[model samples]
Target: MAQAKTTLRTTAAAKAASKAPTNATADKLVGTLRDTMVSLVRRDGPDLSARQLAVFLTCYLQEEGHTVRGLAAELNVSKPAITRALDRLGELDLARRKVDPLDRRSVLVQRTLKGAAYLREIRSIMGETSTVAKKETETRVVRATRRAA
Candidate 1:
């Protein structure tokens, strides 16, 4: 007696593979996101580079009483990375480091008056830009969607 032919097919497997993101596409997306964040920060304050602004924001947040460890975790960066950023801000005289009086082992970062002024200016610019961007995006999305007759 002859046995029926056995066959294996992978059409679904091929389609699934096709749907996956390519490394190049992922890299391009990362680059675009970096550029956009930089643009937004620049729109907020043309004076600070993206890196500088990132450091400044971290210091400002800490000055508002956030801990360095907390900021590092929230930012998804290592403690050293956060510390380096803070160092840059300190070097610029925008932030200062102080030893926690309650815990001698802990060092706290605080924003200086200059830092506060810079942050205020950035907030004003960012607020205006954010308003415009929100309106523009809303209009575009509405225009793109179909409306009932």
Candidate 2:
């Protein structure tokens, strides 16, 4: 009975693996991210650090009303680290701080036009990179199948 249960579990796992999405999609996403980072550094030349990139993406991707304490907690980092990232972002004109009128002690992280434009450009780069990566992957697969047969 135990042997039968183990066989059944193994078969189920195999079926789940077969039904999983192709690795090509994941590869394309990774390629797109890498290309986007390179483009940001080469073309735009802001040369942001990893933390800065994380903070930037989170702010743009998420809704407004982001606070230092909230961001620090969400990112699992220290408040000073968040503050440093915010400082760098402010210097690059990607983000700014605003005193929350409701809470004088809290500061709000506000988005800038430059930051929005940067995000749009990154989106375009990622789209283009994904398209190219998908085409390459398809071509490679076709060649491999042809050689196999």
**Model 1 collision count:** 0
**Across residues 1-149, which tens digit of lDDT does each residue of candidate 1 receive?**
12322222355666667766576456545555554565555564334555567767876755366556766777777888777777777776777778889988777777788888877865665565556565665786687784631
Compared with the true structure, model 2 gives a TM-score of 0.84
Tens-digit lDDT track of model 2 for 48-148: 89999899999999986799999999999999999999999999999999999999999899999999988898899888877888888789999999999
- Cα lDDT of all candidates, in order? 0.66, 0.89
Off by over 4 Å in 1: 1-52, 58-64, 131-149
User: Model 2, 31: alpha-carbon shift in Å?
Assistant: 2.5
The candidate that achieves the highest lDDT relative to the unseen native structure = 2
What is candidate 2's CA lDDT for residue 22? 58
What TM-score would every model get versus the actual structure?
Answer: 0.51, 0.84
**How many clashes does each candidate structure show, in the order listed?**
0, 0
